[model samples]
Target: MKYALGPILYYWPKKQVEEFYQLAKASNADVIYMGETVCSKRRMLRNGQWLDLAKEVAQTGKQVVLSTMALIESPSELRNMQALVDNGDFIVEANDFSAIDLAKQAKVPFVCGPSVNIYNGSALKLLVKQGMQRWVMPVELGRDWLIRLLDECSNLGIREQFEVEVFAFGHLPLAYSARCFTAQSEGRTKDECETCCIKYPQGRPIVSQEQQRLFRLNGIQTLSNDCYDLINDQASMGGLVDVLRLSPIGIDTIEHLEAFRQQNDKDRPFPTPDTVNGYWHKLAGIRQSEDEA
Candidate 1:
């Protein structure tokens, strides 16, 4: 299977964003997803800047897909999604229903980001008709459920029309909200907040009373406390998945990409990545199989 780099979920400076994509162009990720999937208020790179970056990245022979904001709160965001779909130079990942409609109207083959809840065989088939060529499995779904979904797709005979991608690395994006948690934590209103998220490139962590990390607070998106590692489980995806999406955290991203590549390319077994894989095994989202043992 090949690898893909998911969009940057945190708000960062414009220069850091540019430099990150430059490193991504040289990494082992087969497909690179761009644009913002989180808060649109954090616009370090505007719409024109993102499309320009998409053009530059596409020249590197890597498949680039622009991602839409998961929660489109305004007409401007809808227009942005439309522009991304009609860009003609790259594919767009439809993160919301409006994005799906935009891409369908444009008659372009779009990708369904994990945030878009595509669960069963019928849903997959319908999206395929809507010109969805790739679908990333929802982060909370396990292997058994995915196998069933694919089996149902096989029965429908449209399995080959689309590719299956899994969110295999990085902290899982659990949920999003209409309220900005970061701003609330900082005692600022969402509209007037001074873009406090930019000060936190990796997001602020939420810890329990015992001081264990429970969640990560990006502007409005709630992510998992720990990064996920599935580099060792490559063999299980042989017939099920076509691409593995590695989400971008704040640090050591290319190194993670290279490690995944090495693991996917060889059989000697690379060193373990100290992240959780509980959700993959169908246990509680945070409890690993060994944890129960």
Candidate 2:
């Protein structure tokens, strides 16, 4: 199937963000998602920057999708989401219900980001009615759950309306909150935090006293300790999944993307997971089970 580069979750400097897109444009990703899906305060590359980049990359025959923030705090954020929906050029990935409404009102086809709750067929039907073109599978759910959900959608007679994409790489976005954990970790209140997350390009690691990674802290978002990998599980997605999404992480992300693009090659080697796999096999998300892949 096709490959998609998920939006950057970390906050990098404006120049670095620009440079990253240049690399992304030359990469093997068919679809590239860009925007600040994490803390809004880390506005190194704002919405304008994202749209401009989208246009620049789209010219190379690559599709671009602008992603909205998961947690909308103020009216400004809502306004930004509305603008993203009304952009009229690039596709927008709705990370929240407010964005879904905006896209519905704009009559713009959108993608339901993995953060949104789309557990069953009924919900899928409703979103399809709202002009959703693609639906990203939630990171927590496993293969069996997806099978049942697709079956339900098929029974509803509307399974063909949208493409299915999976989070095939990177740290799983577990949860989001109004509270900025990164700020808290630095002993600064959310308002007085001074955008401390900018210091962490890939987010700060929350390690246990035993020097084991417990979780990753990024503003209000709580990420999995170990980066969840599912490249080897691509075979299972045959006929079921249309797109494989690789979330941006590390300096060698382009190399990883190329490796995933050539996943069908038997001689091609896959990147080793920093820690372990997630719930794709219905096991503990953070469990580094030696018995499993």
Candidate 3:
């Protein structure tokens, strides 16, 4: 299966963002997704800069895709989505319904990001008609759900029309809101928050009363406390998934990508801590199955 570097969900400094993509340019990633998928206030790299970066990455023979924001709270954000859809060089990942509409209106092939709720075969078939070339399954759905969906797709004779991608690694994005949780935690309003999400590159962790990590708060997105790891679960995805998406978290992400590329032995022990594979096994998203554990 092809490996895809997903969009950075956290707000990172411009230099760090550029450096990370530099590593990605030389890494084993077959597809690279760039742009802001979270809050719009995190503008360390504007739309023009992201487009430039996409062009640079495309030079390496890797497919580049511009990802749209998951939550569009204003007309300006909608216009930004329109601009991304209008980008003639590369395809765009539509994270919201508005973005999907924009891509459809522009008559360009688009990827349906995980944030878009495409749950059924009918939805997938209709989107194929609208120029959806790829579909990244939602993080909450498990293997069983995918099996059923693909079966339905095969029954409908549209299974070969689009590629299937899964969020294989990184902290699962659970939800998004209008309020910026990072700013709220800093005792500031969303408007005057000063773009403080850049302070926590991996996002601010939220723990329970007993100090157990529960979730991560990144600007407006709520993510799982544990990283969802499926590096060792490739056997389960052999024929089902076309691409495995790995979200960038830190500098070590390049190392993980290399490991994923060279992984031939399925018996190797999982090398990371605070990781969960339960979501792939139809269990609680936060719990790791005994076999995988």
Candidate 4:
């Protein structure tokens, strides 16, 4: 299976963002996804900048994909998505339905992002018909459900058309809101709020009353409280997933990528984390536990 470094979710300074990818190019990641995905207002790098970065990454022999914002709140964001699709140099990851429409209209083979809610065989077939060459399993969907979907595709005879990707590392992005929690926490209005998220580069951590990390706050996005360490599950997920995606969190993601590359067990026990996998199991969405394997 190949490895893909998902978009840099946090807002880093422009130079730092460029530097991170430079380091990533030397890493074991096979595919590189770039562009602003979380908050459009956090524009440390502009559309042209991302396109340029895509070109630079492509030079490193990594297939570069430009990603769209998950939540398009304005006309400008829509236009941005259009431009990303229009840019002929690389493929685009359609995060929203509108992005899918634009990519189809452009007649480009696109990747369906996790937020698109693709649930079954029919949906997968329809997406393939609409020009989706690859699909990312929704973050909350588990192995059992994924196996069922894959089996359905096999029975239906359309399994070869799409590559399945899984979010294997980093803090899972749980949900996003229209309201900016970072601003609210700082007693500022969403519109007028200074980009407070800039301070907490990886996002502000949310803790419970007992001082346990319960979640992470990134502007309007809520992430898992425990940093997911899935290096051990790499082998078990080998044949089922085509690409293992590691969403960028901090500067030190190279080690995580390397660990997965060197793993050996196909049904290896998952590495224990002090956070919840509730969202993945269709459970509480915040319950934490260690899988005994």
Query: 19-68, model 3: which lDDT tens digit per residue?
Result: 99999999989999999999877788888999989999999999999999
Better of 1 and 4 by TM-score: 1
Residues 120-222 of candidate 4: C-alpha lDDT, one tens digit per residue = 9999898899999899988877777888899999988899989999887778887888998888888899998778888888888978899888788888888
List lDDT for all candidates, in order. Answer: 0.87, 0.86, 0.91, 0.82
Candidate achieving higher lDDT, 2 or 4: 2
Query: What TM-score quantifies how close candidate 1 is to the native fold?
Result: 0.96
| Residues 1-293, model 1: lDDT tens digits | 88899999989889899999988888777999999888778788988999999888888899999999999999887887788888888888999888998899889889999999888999899999999999999999878899998999999999999999999988899999999999998999999878998877778888999999989889999988887878877877889999999888854887888888777767775565457778878887776545677
Candidate 2 off by > 4 Å: 209-211, 267-273, 288-290
**lDDT accuracy of residue 67 in candidate 4:** 92
lDDT of 2 by residue, 180-235 (tens): 99999999999999999888877899888998887899889999878877776777
Cα distance off (Å), candidate 2, residue 105: 0.6
Superposition-based RMSD of candidate 4 using all C-alpha atoms, in angstroms? 2.3
RMSD of each: 1.4, 1.6, 1.3, 2.3
Better of 3 and 4 by TM-score: 3
Candidate 4's C-alpha runs over 4 A off are 209-211, 265-293
Highest lDDT model number: 3
Backbone clash tally for model 2?
Answer: 0
Model 1 weakest lDDT span, ten residues long: 265-274
